[model samples]
Target: MKIAVLGTGGGARAHIAKLAALGHEVHVGTRDPQATLARTAPDMMGNAPFGQWLADHPGVALHPFGDAAARGELVINGIDGRNAVAALSAVADRLAGKTLIDYAVPYRYDPDLEHPWPTPWGVMPAMEPVDTDSLGEQIQRALPATAVVKSFVTQEQTTVVDPASVAGGDHTMFVAGDDADAKRQTTDLLTAYGWRDVLDLGPLVCARGMEMYAHLHSAIGFGLGQQFGGHFGIKVMR
Candidate 1:
């Protein structure tokens, strides 16, 4: 499978490495490939520099957004939540008739961000389109021809790639999309990553719940004194 992953941060690197390792031809897309490779410092999230990570993974190719999207059989939106639509919009024509796996949460922390350390998990981060719609839905709206599957947004990076490493793979991840074939394809990809419990929440509108779950996810991380560690995941006990 030829996969194009967007973004230059940790999430993009993780996806590129894993998908390439899984024998998929992976290409990473960024606004500017040269600028991305010129990055010398670690990212805001404390992940290694993009240049460094790219050097380690020679099998993955880097290209401009449209070029990558044109070349991919499947596209993964690993870009920041706020920039997803704008970034993908540049490649909208190429993305038509392809499965787009959305893994971004539209939440931004204020500059004066301060967590209450080891107690009640402070206030939730400010998110966009809160009560009315979700980022996933917005992405779908932006690319109506593309099959947008909202997934992999609620877990840590390690958990997204290797679910078995945490909780014995008992936790559940979700897929919400209007297209049944797209959802099935996304499920197969998730299963390849060791995700055992994939629940299709039905229709893209349900993505609002998945996006909002980030609040509870943050609360649990704060309560556990480990911000977004791989030790915890959401499980449906029937």
Candidate 2:
């Protein structure tokens, strides 16, 4: 699969790592493509000089914007909620008829919000309420021709991927989208990345519940330990 990952955050790096591991040709886009490529190279292939490898493999290109978006068979948005729309706006047209996986939430950053600062029990104060529709909806509205599916927001990178490290075998990851084909594409992608049990929670609106799941997980993490990386699964009682 020719995969293009946007943004330069941990979430984007996580997608890049998983996609590259699957033997897919991955193109990464960020504000500083060179710097982002350098940082990700370490996490991607250990001591393999991935940057030079990418440079050597002219077929595999890591570009800034248009090249990355235009060439990808599948596009993934790994940007922060705040910058998600603006960051991906450039490639909206290129995404037409493509399966675009959206992993963005709608968490707002407010200075007036009062939570806890740096303390043993770290806590982020509540800010303005999220749209609940998620940045994905906005992107979908922008690029109507492109199929947008929302999934993987309920995880903390550590848990959604390689769930064996924590607990529960084949942990479940929720998938939501309006388009069937797009949802299938994301489902296949998730399974390839090691998520064995993917729960299709139905239409894109379900994403609102999934986003709130993150907020709840955050609170739970504060109560448990400072570090919060976990996932959820539905257990049906027969």
Candidate 3:
């Protein structure tokens, strides 16, 4: 599959590397390709020198502006929480008829303890509910023609790449999307990226619960010293 990871941060880089490692045609999508290369070149050289050495290798491309948007069969939005909607809007038209893997959380991150995170976990006082009616829903609303599958947001990035190394033994990866075929395709991609256990929580509305898991897990990590070594998982008994 030709996958485009749209963003230029650690998350975006992780997507790029994972796709490359899995033998997918991958592209690093950035508005400023030069800036991404500038920031990434140094780190890739030090931490992943071998991957850096494979810079000239096939199956990976770095694209700027709109070109990256036009090339992908699958577009993964790995941008920051706040910037996801705006950044993705730049290529919304091109995204029509594409299975857009939305890894977004529309939270302000104000550190307010009074709030119950948002809809999906619980409802807001003066606002609407947050499930299929939530932020992911909003993005889907914005791109009606694009098949949006809300996934890859419940667990930490490292956990997604290596479940064995995750603190809580094996974890569950849940997905919510309106399209069954798209969900299945996304599931296959997740499997290739190393997810051993998965749960399909029905429609995209279920993203509310999945997003809430992230908030709760984040709080748990903070309480445990934020060493990036803490995690939470579901246990099912037959």
Candidate 4:
């Protein structure tokens, strides 16, 4: 499988590492490959520089967005939710007839806050109103010919790659898309990452619930004193 993962953040790095470990030909897509490699400082969350990770994983190739998307059999949208559409637009034509696993959530961070703060608990980001439409739906609409599957949005980076890191491995992750084949492919990828309780919530519209759940997810993280520390996940008991 030739997989292209976009972004240089922790989420993208995790996906790249795990997918590469699975023996897929992985290409990392970024806006500026040279700038990304030249970055010496950690990200806003203080995670280690992506350059270090890139150095460690020599098997992964880095390319600009268009080139990476053109070369991939499967494309993972790990870019920031706010800029996902703009970033992917560069490769929109190449995405036709391919499975696009979208992990981008329309999460609006407060510019005033230096880091994501647990405040006004159980509230969704103001910018993305769940009642309207989700980021997944928007992206799907943007690329009508692409099979966009919404997934991995509710998880932390660690748990997205290794679901077993959470207790009992009994928690649930979601898949939502109009295409059955795309959902199945996304599910298989999740399973390969040790996710045992993947639930298909049906159609891309259901992503509304998934995206809205960010509030509760954030509340749980705040209660635990850790925002997605791989120790907790939403579990469906039934």
Identify the candidate with maximal TM-score: 1
Looking at model 4, residue 120 earns an lDDT score of 44
**lDDT for each of the candidates?**
0.86, 0.68, 0.69, 0.84
Ranking by TM-score: 1, 4, 2, 3
List, residue by residue over 76-154, the lDDT tens digit for candidate 4. Answer: 9989889998888767998889999998768776534444444643323554646789888888888999999999988
TM-score against truth, every candidate: 0.93, 0.79, 0.77, 0.91
What lDDT tens digits, residue by residue, belong to model 2 across residues 12-101?
656677677778998877666667556544442143444644554444456776678888899988777777777677667777889888
Ranking by lDDT: 1, 4, 3, 2
Better of 1 and 2 by TM-score: 1
How would you encode candidate 1's per-residue C-alpha lDDT over 200-219 as one tens digit per residue?
99999988998888777877
Question: Each candidate: how many clashes?
Answer: 0, 0, 0, 0
Q: Could you tell me the lDDT of residue 147 within candidate 3? A: 88
Candidate 3: tens digits of C-alpha lDDT, residues 1-238: 8888776555566677677887788876777766555553445213433245347556678786357767988888776666666777777887888888877666554343564544332433222234446667767877888888988787666556555566444667778899988899899888887677778889888877766666566567667766342455554433
Clashes of 3: 0
